[model samples]
Target: MKQNIGRCEFSQFPNLSKTICQEDDISNYVQHLNDLSSDFETRFEDVLTMVIPQLIINPYGDIEETDVILQAELIGISTN
Candidate 1:
């Protein structure tokens, strides 16, 4: 599993402040799994499923509550 954790800034999305703070809890959970001899890939996949949906997609999609809306993730733009 890749240990390279990327950086993310939540200053622009204050609603995500608590979500960002939850990363520490995720890290500790993963560490606990590791100590139990869990595979890195398994741990990463588990954490990703829990964190990504709850923190990024769900919260951002609730437009009535948050302003930081994520439409899509793309590498480049094109027209056909």
Candidate 2:
């Protein structure tokens, strides 16, 4: 989406974008999106360090999840 922006000219821009926010220039809108993406990456930098359990992602996966506490947590998550 970020890569394909402005590569092709739209006959009429999407009405949702226009209705949501006021941007007179397409270039500015593109720039805004770029900034937003950058901001999101910056804010979620800590998420990169997070070691997510494979069992949480795929319960039926052939993963040797040995931690009992983690298994309990997974059960709690599933129950919720």
Candidate 3:
């Protein structure tokens, strides 16, 4: 997937070290977060594709029909 997005060359970080650690720092952080979000979205799409066959065969795997319950059962995440 990273290769699909092209090679991530080790470029130098921008002049973020000079910025005051406040709201402005958020812009830089948000860029990194966006990259991470994109990566996760790509990976999740792959996983969803792999799981679709099981979902079609299993009665309990209807995430498409019931997102709330399905997410709770499949995602095992802790907001805290």
Clashes of each: 0, 0, 0
Compute the lDDT for candidate 1. 0.46
Where model 2 places Cα greater than 4 Å from the true spot, the runs are: 8-24, 63-80
Residue clash pairs of candidate 2: none
Would you estimate the TM-scores of all the predictions?
A: 0.22, 0.52, 0.34
Cα lDDT, model 3, residue 29: 59
Q: Write the per-residue lDDT of candidate 1 for residues 1-80, one digit (tens) a residue.
A: 21322233445556754465456765775577566555656668766566454435553343344332432321111111
Pairs that collide in candidate 3 are none
TM-score: which candidate is best?
2
Residue 1 in model 3: lDDT: 31
RMSDs, each prediction?
A: 17.4, 6.3, 14.0
Candidate closest to the true structure, highest lDDT = 2
* Residue range 1-80, candidate 3, lDDT tens digits: 32312223223434533434454545555667679988988989877667555645764654555556566765443232
Between candidates 1 and 3, name the one with more favorable lDDT.
Answer: 3
* Tens-place lDDT digits, model 2, residues 1-80: 64445443433557544443433455676888899989988999899778887775787554246476666666666577
Q: Could you give the candidate ranking by lDDT, starting with the highest?
A: 2, 3, 1
> lDDT value for candidate 3?
0.53
